[model samples]
Target: MSKIRVAVFGCGAIAQRRHIPEYASNPNVELVAFADPNKQRAEEVAAEYGGKAYENYEDILKNEKLDAVSVCTPNYLHAPMTIAAANAGLHVLVEKPMAVTAEEGEQMIEAAAKNNVYLMVGHNQRLMPPHVKAKEILESGRLGRVLTFRTSFGHPGPEGWSLDGRDSWFFRKDEALMGAMGDLGVHKSDFIRYLLNDEVVEVAGFIGTIHKEDTDVDDNATCIVRMKSGAIGTLMASWTHYKGGDNGTVLWCENGVVKIGTGQGDEVIVELTNGTVETYKVGAMATNEKQVPSGVIDDFVQSIITKTPPTISGEEGLRSLKVILGAFESQDTGSIVKL
Candidate 1:
């Protein structure tokens, strides 16, 4: 079969670090074009990775012979870009928090459906090997029914992660929308939902901007969720953990507790009520400076080649996004929100 002609939209940190490199490595993909409002970034990526660069993303859709494109733009732009790319008959691998608004997410999902293209979201936490193993254990009923859980993803902030440092779009409400909730909390929501095979039914949350100076978006966000199975969980996303970053989850279950991303290695530790502890080594989580492709890109390419649906479909992204946006509503009202 011929390679899937691919272009990358938005030449930001994610595009340069993940999408571009991963697609370059995938034998099934042919790098055709790159685009960003900042023509320099796109030109740089194209120079290193072999592609034509365009300042206007529309040019890629109009000119490139592409089967897929990864949408690595800011949060607010995800829906429009995904919709446009899908409408162009190109499969899309979009960043997480699929859209800033659930309504936008729905529109993106509908666009993909109408255009007959695959739309995948970059909730890469689920691709962490331990997370994959955790899902397996939960699905096998090895941990019994989930009772409650706590999951968190925290780090110093995008100042350390984004290419533009503190001046990055991530700090602006006009650009990135909400901060940690959209950035990390949404990822955790999706991760927990996948790990438990359940959906968030309700949310109670607190969103704040206690850390970053001159930043309008929330730097910290915490939410409690009730799952469809009557399981309750706490989800947290923070960009002010000055001490150290922790990305992990602990699930208390009827038979035992599933501890994920815990300890030295990327291990999922299962502790039974009977005091039996079993640890499974999956793989290490990626960091900003030392990131590798999170398997999302690989899965996307394979799904296209096999004529299969993406595992993290646009609808899947919407469900997770609902929890985050619902968290915002809960925070605003200081009450519970039913998803």
Candidate 2:
């Protein structure tokens, strides 16, 4: 079997810690090139993966031989990079918050379609075993039509991951857009939507900067969602939580509740209507290490090979982005916004 030739833009933490490592270990992919504005960073990461470095992403796109490219840039760069890669006839696995705005996301979707290329969003939560199990149980009606859902995803500030620390592009309105909602809110919105198989029809929400002093963007946000299925839900995302509990999602259905964490070695807990509760530890359930996988990239590779829709396609990313954007609109106008 021939390996898929791939290039990666943005040699940042997510790319270093997850993307590169995952692709490095996958025999089906050939890591061909790396691109980042910072030459040294790109060179270091590329050296580890046995790839060449390009100071400009265009250099990689100019290569006619690559089959796919991973867009791992900041939130703002997602759309333009993905569209460019697609136009270059390369499949794209873009990082989450597909774009800062829904319009941009649509452009990405259109570009992928026009180019006849695969476009997948890197929402790795969908690949977690507990989350996978939750999707299965929820779909099987063991949860009995998710009536209400409340989920939150938060962490300490992006000091470790973001390049600029507290003054990172993440805190800049022009580069990061709406802060907490875009960074964490959208992820939860997407995860819940995938697990419950429902769309948010309306949202009444608020965004604020409860912490992270001197920053213009919101560090905390909460929103109430009206799902298309007539179910109600609430979501919170923040960087203000001092202790940093990490990401967590909870679904309340007619029968019971299910909860999962965003960290490694975590388990999924279930509570049934009869008051019988069970906690299915991920490692115990899967007979493998309980950690996030580069399954998103693996799935993207398969989608490109088989001409199939990725589990988290660009269109799916747009829908999830809509909820978060709607939340911002709701907060600004003090009114419920329809999807």
lDDT of all predictions? 0.90, 0.82
My TM-score estimates for the predictions, one after another, are 0.98, 0.93
State which candidate has the highest lDDT: 1
* Tens-place lDDT digits, model 1, residues 264-301: 53898999999999989877877665685689899999
| True-vs-predicted CA distance for residue 41, candidate 1, Å | 1.2
Which runs of model 2 end up more than 4 angstroms from their true locations? 262-265, 284-291
- How many angstroms is residue 24 displaced in model 1 relative to the true structure, after the best TM-score fit? 0.5
- Candidate 2 versus truth, CA RMSD in Å, comes to 2.8
Q: Write the per-residue lDDT of candidate 2 for residues 179-239, one digit (tens) a residue.
A: 8787778888998888878889999988888768767888898899989999998899988
Error of 1 at 17 (Å): 1.1
lDDT for residue 300 in candidate 2, whole number 0-100: 83
The model with the greatest TM-score is 1
